[model samples]
Target: MQAYKLAEQALVGKRNADTVALAMYFVPQPVSRKDGFRRTVNIKANPMGFATGSNLNFDLGLPKLMAKAKPVFCEAFRLEGHYESKSGYPTTVSVQSDSDGDFKVVSMQRLFPNVSQDSLQQLHGELAQQYASAIKAGIAKLEMKTPRVELRFMHPIMIQGAGAGSDEASKLFQAHWQQGWMEFKGKNIGLLGAMKTVADHNKNSVPACKPQVLTLN
Candidate 1:
């Protein structure tokens, strides 16, 4: 599967590299049926405008970007590749690996220590409603037979293990994450599960999104 390949790639030069983060969404329909459902992966080396911290986070700018690029998916599978933050830094989320092939994420219920979870959930619900309205309007304008799309934002953490003494800090820091794609058929779905995380500055591992079939009607 795509997740397996991405995990392998993350470990290519850096052995300890384990976890990866991803943001899944939809893209514009392709030109032809032959192009519909074909998957692509894009590497983002530029830095993003998101703020960093212990938990996954997002910036006001991200939604603006999404609003500008309204994507819809009918049906789509997953794909993988290298990507980085818009700020030219590593992928957003980072964490410590509890064991091989398994990682923990900051629970959605506890994203911000100061804010109550109920309030955050309510806020996200409102946002999703607004996004859904916008996405519906956007998708309505597309031509029939426009294949669904899955636009992903990939963030992988490639760091040097403690005591390795590689002295290639710049090269390691220059390491990248991925943005990926996929497509299919449907009315288009929208769901917001998690925001990307910051680079694992403490040499901590990050988290990986398990491949899943997500559909929003």
Candidate 2:
């Protein structure tokens, strides 16, 4: 079966579980542009309830399923988004990076049932390893049509504060912004990484805020 088809099927199977929504193959154009690449493909599989604003989360087992099936799909596409939640939401398993080279998983939220901190970290590490392996294998076989594209995960601070046009309230808490980016086989990856580091420094140097902005890139 095709990789996307397999991913879609896996997503459908997982959606039958509790409040779980899966969005597979999310290719953001801005991310591509930031990395100096243009993507012609976008693939995704979002769980049904997410669009309706239902409280849906991913089944913890879905990653296992995705891992098992990813070999097939990764050949044509790169997996992105929260493997454990919907877009812009907190999740125990999240995938980021564009379709070309770099990808990272942030399993910060212990939202999965029966998941411990140690176990979550272990899972995160394992997923990262597996994804790297899959991507390498996929790239070896596939033909990249466009100029190699990298993804720059933007910091909310870059788009907010001082000259960013954000309001006083946003600028006041801009120090709380955190960001990261992955460099595919393209440029600006280093720029994005530097931005994230600077943002983290700014956040840490300032006094804590009561309610700070937490934007994940």
Candidate 3:
């Protein structure tokens, strides 16, 4: 209850703050069923920004209400800041891995096809590296104890503002936990828990048997 109040207070008057926006994601977990088979659940968390005109807004009060009602969600969501600009580079990429330790980029697409190959590759590498780092960190933090993981980018990640270029942006995103730079209104949640919160926020319904990603508006 108190956490939601603080978060709301922090978000006050920040609706139109467009230069940078705070974003959060819920961590995913694996569940075992009665059939002796294991599978990941609720991986379709929506990616949203708190800035005005985005999927969420402070006036809706859902974000705050969610923060208060879902302690597990609060404990599991990962928070980060998006420094966006008109010059930002946007792209989408998907990653997959198996129990045999086989990992690779499944597919990638540049939002602007006219962009140079060098620019595209640079953006691709940065996106790939960021996702890989996040996945590995989530696995370690949550102690999921699984050697296999999968990630699919449902939305384009914007790279802009300071050090928006490939090399600099990579460094900035890789070291995303510098407390003094990012804002935290409530309790600090682990990567796994954050992912779960996002899933619930997006209302992802887990299937009876396998893991799947669903796109929600």
lDDT of 3: 0.30
By lDDT rank, best first, the candidates go 2, 3, 1
Model 3 RMSD vs true structure: 18.6
lDDT of 3 at 147: 27
Q: Write the per-residue lDDT of candidate 3 for residues 3-39, one digit (tens) a residue.
A: 3333333343233222122222222232323222222
Give per-residue lDDT, candidate 2, residue 14: 38
lDDT of each: 0.26, 0.31, 0.30
Clashing pairs in 2: 19-56, 19-57, 20-57, 22-45, 22-47, 23-45, 24-44, 24-45, 25-43
Model 2 per-residue lDDT tens digits across residues 109-204 = 222222265655555455445444222322111222133212122233223222223354344323323333332212324434544543454345
**TM-score to true structure, per model:** 0.16, 0.23, 0.19
Using TM-score, give the best candidate's number.
Answer: 2
Note each model's CA RMSD in angstroms: 23.4, 21.9, 18.6
Compared with the true structure, model 1 gives a TM-score of: 0.16
Q: How close to the true structure is residue 179 of candidate 3, measured as C-alpha lDDT?
A: 20
* lDDT, model 1: 0.26
Q: Which residue segments of model 2 deviate by more than 4 Å?
A: 1-57, 74-93, 97-103, 106-186, 189-217
